[model samples]
Target: MLQIRKILLRGAGLEDALVQFYSGANVLAGESDTGKSFLLECINFILGAEKLTLVDEAKPYTHLAVEFVNSNDETITLVRPTSGGKVAAYHVPIADISGSGQSIAPTRKGKSKGPDVTSVLLPFAGIKEARLRRNVEGETQRFTIRTIESLFLVDEVAVIDQQSPVTGKATFGDTAQKRALSYILTGVDDESVAAGEKNEIVKARLKAKLELVNEMLQPLNERFASPGELTVLTDDTELDTLIGSLTGELENLATTRDAIQERSQEATRNILKADSQLLGIRELLSRYRLLDERYTSDLDRLDFISEGSFYFDALQEVPCPVCDQIMAPGHSHGPDSTALPIRESAVAEAAKIHAHRTDLAAAIRDLEVRLGSVEGEKHTIDTELKSLNTELSRTLAPRLEFTTERLEQLVNRHTEREATRVERERWQELVKLQNDINSSLAESGTPKQIWAGIPPKELGEFCAEIQAVLSEWKWKGTPHVEFDEKTFDITVDGKPRQSHGKGVRAVLYAALVIGLLRYAAKNHRPHPGLIVIDSPLTSYKKKKNQTVKGENGQIDAGVEAAFWKSLAKTSKDIQVIVIENKEPPTEMAAEVHYQWFAGEEAKADERAGFIPTKSAPAN
Candidate 1:
C-alpha cells in the first residue's frame, strides 16, 4: 500500500509548514480559506501535476516535498521546485532528502534523459508499463500516473459535479479514463490490439469524421450571440455570487418570520393561561356569594331568637307545662331536659356569624380583584397576538414570499448558466475531436484497435463493493448500485448517478473512490491504495443553498455519523485523507488521526493553518 507519511513546504524566510498522515485515515478539518484545498493541490503537484496553483499565502514557499512509503515498504521522498523543474527522489526520509539524489523528469518530454515521474511511481502501485488507445486509428498514449490520479485525488469542484466520478469535465479525457479503469480492473491494455488500415481509406474515414464533428460544433458556437458571452459562461463566479446573495436574503426573511411566529405562540399560551385563571376566580366568587347569603340568613335568625328570649326572660319564672310546678328562670324542669339560653346566647351566636360573614366578604372582594386582573391580562395577550399575526402576515410573510420568488428566479438562472457551460464544454470537445481526426488524416499510417472492456463479473463485484460502502454509511434505502458500462459510471437503483443533487453526487463520488480501493484489495488488483478527497461531506455542512437529502425524500441524519464510523474502520492497507470544513463525529476521535486548522491562533498549541503565521529561516 502507498501511504503518504508527511509533507513539508520550505522557503528562505518562512517557517516549514508540516502535515503528517497515517496508514488508516487522516482528517484535516476546520474553517475555510485555511489552506485545505491548497494542501490538496500541493499533493497533486508533487504527484506530477503539470502546474502548481499558487495563492498569495503560498507565495513565500519555494519548494514542496512529500515523503511516502511505497507498496514495498520502502520510504521515498520527492522534492520539487515550486517554480517547475525535475523532481528529486531520495530513497530516505524527508530529513535526509536534501543534497544529491536521483533526478526524475517531471514530464515524459522533459529535456533530461532521466526517467519520468510516471515511470517511477507506476511501479509503486504494482502496475507495469501500460499504453491506452487514444483514437479510433489505434493511436496510443503511454499510461501515466495522471491517468489514474482522478481515482485517488478528488478536488472540491469535481466532488459535487454532475459528471462521471471517474471522468473529468473535459470530454476529451473520457476515453482515457475508461481505458485506465479497465486496465485496473481487468489487467488488460490495448498494446496488442491490431492497428487500423493505412493510406487513402484511412484518410477518407478521418476526413468524414472531421466533417461530422464540425457539423456538431456549428450550432453550439452559434448558441451564444457573441464569443464574449460564451467566455463569460466559462466562469461560474458571477452566477455563484448572485445565487449566494439571493439565498442570504431568503434566509434573513425566514429567520424574521420564525421569530415572529415564536413570539405569537408564546402570546397565545399566555392568553390561555389567563383565561383559565379568570374562570377559577369567577367560580370562587360564585361560591363566596352563596356563603354570604347564608351568613345573612343566620344573622337575621339569631337576632329574632335574641329578641324572643328577652321577652321570655321578662315574663318571670313560669311553671313547666308538664310539671305544673314553679321553676326558676334558666333552670331545667326534669333530669332529661336542658336549661334554655337567654338573649346572651343568641347575641353571641350572632357575633360569631358576623365575623365569618366579614371574612367571606373580604375573600370575595379579593377574588373579584384577581378576576379583573386576569381579564385585563388576557386582553393584553390577545392584542399582542393580533399584532404579531398582522406582522407575520403583512410584513414578514410578504417579504418572505418576495425573497423566495427571487431566490427561485436566481436558481433558475443558475441552471441556465450551467446548461450554457455544458454546451460550451461540448463545443470544446467537438473542436478537439475535429483536431484529432485531422491529425489522423495527416499521419502516414493509422492503426485500429479493439480494447477489451472490464469483465462483467468484475464490474458486478465492483458495484457490489460500492453498495456495501454506501450501506455502511447508512444511505437511504440501501439502493442497488450498478456499473453502467455504456456511460462508464455507476447507477443507483436504476437511476443515473448524475440525476441526484450535488450533495448526493459528492458522497456518491467518495463512495466510488473508496469502493475502488476496497475492490482492488480484495481482488488483488493494482491500486495506489491512497485516496485524498476534499469536501466529500460538504453537503452535510450547514451552509447556505446546501440541502442533503436521501432517497426517501427526508434528510438522512445518520449519514454523517455512519460515514465517520465507517472510515474509522478502514483497513490498515489503505490510507485515506479527507479535508473538510466540519469536524468528524466525536466518537471516532480516537480511531483516526485528526488535525484542526483553527484558522486563528487562539492558543499557543493550536495551529493557525497550513501556512504558519510566523516566518523562520529554512535550515
Candidate 2:
C-alpha cells in the first residue's frame, strides 16, 4: 500500500508551489486554464514515466519532490530532476534535502541495471519480483511499476473518454493488461503459476513432434473405410497386427515375381540361340549361291560344245584345195593318218559334257529350297519371344511391383508410429509434473481460485459496486453499468460507452476508476491505495450557457451534489485527489477538503491560482 503523502515543485526563479493531501478525498477546483492539470503531470514525472510536461508558468521549475508512505509506515522522499534526468531517492524527509542519496537512473523498464524506480517502489507496495505474459504464445516480461500506475493516476483526457482503467495510452498488449490486473488483485505472477521443469523449450519440441505425428497419420487414416478408426490404433499390439498382414501380402507378391523373371530369362536365351543359328545359315546360303552360279555357267558352255560337235559329225567330207574337186571322207592337210581318231574322240567328249551340265542344275534347285526353310524357322522364333516379353510387362510385373511398394509403406509407418509413442510418453510426463506443481501450490495455502486468476464472480461483485456508485451519483435512465469481458469496456444501459457523448463518457469513466478504488480497498486487494482524478465531472460545467447533457438526457440539477457526496462517503479509507472546474456543492463543502484558484485578477495576497503570486504560499 504505497500512498503519496505530499508533492512539492520548486525552482530558483519561480515561486515554490506546494500541495498537501490527506487520506480522504481532496478537491482542487478553479477557473479554466489554471494549473490544476499540471499537478497530475508532475506526479507522473516523479514516477518512472519517459516524458514530462509542465504548464507555461511552471516551466521555470527544475526539480520535483514526492514523499510517499510505504506499507511499513516508512516515508521515502523521491527527488528527481524536473527537466528529465537521473532520480535520487532518500529515506529521510524531503525537507531535509542533502546533496546526495541513492541514485536511480530514469530508463525504460527491462533495459537497466539493479536499482531503478520499480525495484525501489515494488517492495513498498508489497509486490514480489514477477513477470507477465505479453501474449498467449509470446515471451513473458518482468512487471514494472509503470503498469500499476494507471490505477493510481487518471489525467484529464483519460478521465473523459478511455474505457478500461487498467489500459494506458501506450499499448501493453492484451495478455499483459490482464496479467497486470491479476497481479494487483491477487498477489500472483506468471512465475508462480508456470511449472518449472516444463519450460518453453520442452513444450515447443513436443509440439513439433506432435504435429509431425498427426501429419503422418492423416494418409494412413485415408486407407481405412472409417478414418476415425485410427484413434484406437496407438498401442503396439494394434500396429503389429497391421504389419503382419502387410508382410503376408508382400510374400505372395515375391513368389509371383520370381516366376515371371525366370520365364523372361528363358525366352531371352532362346531368342539369342535362334539369332546365332540364322547368322550361320545366311553365310552358308551366300557361298552355295556363288557355287551354283559357276556350275550353271559351265553347263551352258558344255551345251554349246555338244551342239557344235553334232554339226561337225554331219559334215563328214571336205572340199579340194586347188582344182575344185570333192574331198575324200578324211581330208587332212597335215598328219593325214590322225584325222579319223580325232573325229571319233570329239563325239564322246560332247556326250560326257552334256551329262555333267544336267547334274549341276539339279543340285542348284535343292540348295534354294534349303535356304528358304532356314529363313522361315528364324522368323517363327522371333515372334514367339516378342509375345512372351509383352505378357510379362502388361500383367504379372505390374501387379507384383505394386504389392511390394504398398508393403514397404506400411512397414515404414509402423516404425514412425513407435517413435511417436516415445515422444507422447515424454509429453505426458511433463504434463503430470505441471499438474503436480499446481496441486502443491493449492495445498500450500494459495487460494484454489488464484491459479485461474480473479474469477468472474469476483468481477461481477466489483461491477455491482460500480453500479451502486453510479446510482448514488444519480445517473440518468436506470444506468446499468457492467464490465464487458471481451473489450474490457463499460456497457451503460446495455450500450457500450463509446456510443455515448463525451460528457456522458467522462462521467462513466470516472465511475469505473472510482469503483476500482472502492472495490480494491474493501476487498483488501493489492492496490497502490491512492487514486488521483482530474476533471472527473465534465458534464456539470456551464459551457456556452448550456449545461452538457449525459447518458439518457439532460443531467439533473442535483447530480453534481450527489456525485461529490458519494465520493466524500466512499473515499474515507483511501487518498483520492479530484480536480475539476466546478466547485463542490455548498452543503457537502465541509465534508471534503477543498481549494479554490481565482485566477490572476484577484488581489496579490489572495489565492488566485495553483502557483502563488508575490504575496505568500499556503501550508
Candidate 3:
C-alpha cells in the first residue's frame, strides 16, 4: 500500500510550504477559490500525471515534492519541478530531497528506467515494468502509471462523475481501466505469471481462454434474460414434447379446416340447386299464367256460344232479300238468314259449351295453386342460401386465419429450440474447459482461488459495504443497493447512480471510492490504500438560486454529516483525504485532521490559503 506522509511546495521566489497528512482521515476544509483543489493537481503532477494547469499564484512555485511510504515500509520522496517536466527521485529521507536526486523522464508506457517514478514506485507495490497480455490472441501492453493513478487520486471531475472510480475518461480506454482494477485486486502482474512452469503456463492459457469465452457469453446470457422474449429453454425431450403438441394441434386444425371447406362446398352446391329450382318454378308459373289466360278466353267464348244458341232458337223463320218475299216460316234460304235448329238440339249444344267453361275455370285454379307452392319453396331456399353465405364470411374466415397464425408461431418456436441447443452446447464446452483447468491446478497443488480476477463474491461484498456506508450516511434509498456489473457502477433502489442528482452523485462516488478501499484492505487485496477526493460534499452547501431537487441534486444535512462520520470510521484501515468548501461537522471533528484555509480573513496562519496571499502593508 502506498501512503503519503507529506506534500511540499517550494520555489526560489515563493515561501516554502509543507502539508503533512496522517494515515487516517484528513480534511482540507475552507472557502472556495483558495487553492484547495490545487493540492490534488500537484499530487497528480508528482505522480506522473501528464500536464498541470499553472494557476497565477502557483506560477511562482518551481518545484514540488511528495513523500510517501511504499509497501515495503521504506520511505521514498518523489520530487518534480513545478513547471511540469521530468521527475527526480530520491532514496534519501523526505527532508533531504533538495540535496541529491536522480532525474528521470516519465515514460507513457512500458518498462521504466533510471529516475522514472513508475520504476521506483511500482517496485514497492510488487509490480515491475510488466507486459500484460491484452487479448487471447497474445497481444501485450506494458503497464504504466496512468493506468493505476485513479486508485489514489479522485479528482474534482471524477468526484462527481457518479460512475466507477476506476472507469477511464475520454483519453483512457476501458481496457486500461480493467487492467488497472485487475492489477490492484490481484497484485499479480504479467511478470509474475510469465515465469510459470510449462504445465502452469498451459493451465494459465486454458484459464485465459475460459475467461474470454465467459466474457463472450455474458451478453448472450443477458439477452436471453431480457424482457419480452421467450422464457423457456428446450432440451431434446422438451422439444420433442413441444413438437408433438404443436403437431397434434395442427392436425386438429387441419381437420376442422377441411370440414369447413366441405361445408362451404356443400352450401355452394345447395345454393346453385336452389337457384336452378327457383328458376324452374318461375318458368312453370309463367306457363301457368298463359294457360290461365287461354282458359279464361275459352270460357268467355263458350258463354257467348251458349247465349247465341238461345238467340238462334228465337229465329224460327228466314227472309229472302232479292225477291222481298218471305219463304215458308220454318225454311230460310237467303245468306243472311238461317233456319233455327230444333229446340232440343239447340239446348244440347248450349249445355255442352257451359260444361266446357266450368272445366276451364277449375283448370285455372289448379294452375294458380301449383304456382303458389313453387314460390313458397323458392323463398325458403333463398333464406337458406343467405344463411350459408353469412356463415362463410363471418365465422370460417377468421377461424382459418387464426389457425394459420398459430402454425407460424410453432415454426418459430422450433427455430428457437435449435438456437437454444447450440448455445447450450457452447456453454457446456466452456464449463468443461474451466473444470479441467481447475483440476489441473488442484493436481499441481496450486491454489485455485489465488488472485483469480475479482469474483462475484468479492463484488457482492463490496456492494454490501457500500450499502452499509450509505446506510450510515442516511442515504435516501432502500437498503437493497447493489453493484451493476455491466456499467461498473452502483444502483440505488434499482436506479443507476447517474440517475441521481449531482450532489448525490458526488456522495455516491465518495461512497464507492471509500468503500472499495475498505473492501480492498479487508480482503488483503493489492491496493494503494489511499483515497484523495475533491469537493465530495459540494452539494451540501446551499448555492444561490438552487432549484434542482432530487437524490443527486439536493443535499441532505443528516446524510452529509453521516457521510463524513462513515469516512472517519473507515479511515482507520485506509487513508482518506477529503477536499470540501464546507467546514467539518462537529461530530467528525475529533476523528478527522482538519486544515482550514480561510482566504477571506486577514490573519496569516488561520485565514491564509494553500498558496500564500500577498503581504499587506504594516499599518
Question: lDDT of each model, Cα atoms only?
Answer: 0.79, 0.67, 0.68
| lDDT leader | 1
TM-score of each: 0.57, 0.55, 0.55
Per-residue CA lDDT of model 1 for 1-619, tens digit only, reads: 5789998899997779898998888999877767888888888999888789776777778999999897688888889998888898888999876677888987777334458787787676577888787666566777777888889999887777666777666576477778788777876787875556656666676677777888887887687547676658356788789789878888888888888889999998898899888888888898889989988998888888766654554555667777777766545663223314646687788889889988898898889888888888888889899999999888888888888888788788878878877787778767766776666555564523223467667888889999999999998886699888776778988888777776778888899999998998787777788899998887543344753334322225698789999999998888999999878878796789999887754367877788876422110
Arrange candidates, best lDDT first.
1, 3, 2
The clash numbers for all candidates, in the given order, read 4, 0, 3
RMSD of 2: 30.3
What does candidate 1 score on TM? Answer: 0.57
User: Which structure among the candidates has the greatest TM-score?
Assistant: 1
The 10 consecutive residues of candidate 1 with the worst lDDT sum are 546-555
Give the clash total for candidate 2.
Answer: 0
Q: Which prediction has more favorable lDDT, 1 or 2?
A: 1
Whole-model lDDT, model 3: 0.68
lDDT of 1: 0.79
Per-residue alpha-carbon lDDT of model 2 for 92-162, expressed as tens digits? Answer: 77787787889996545455566888778767776567788665444577777676666678876665544
Q: Model 2 misses residue 332 by how many Å?
A: 99
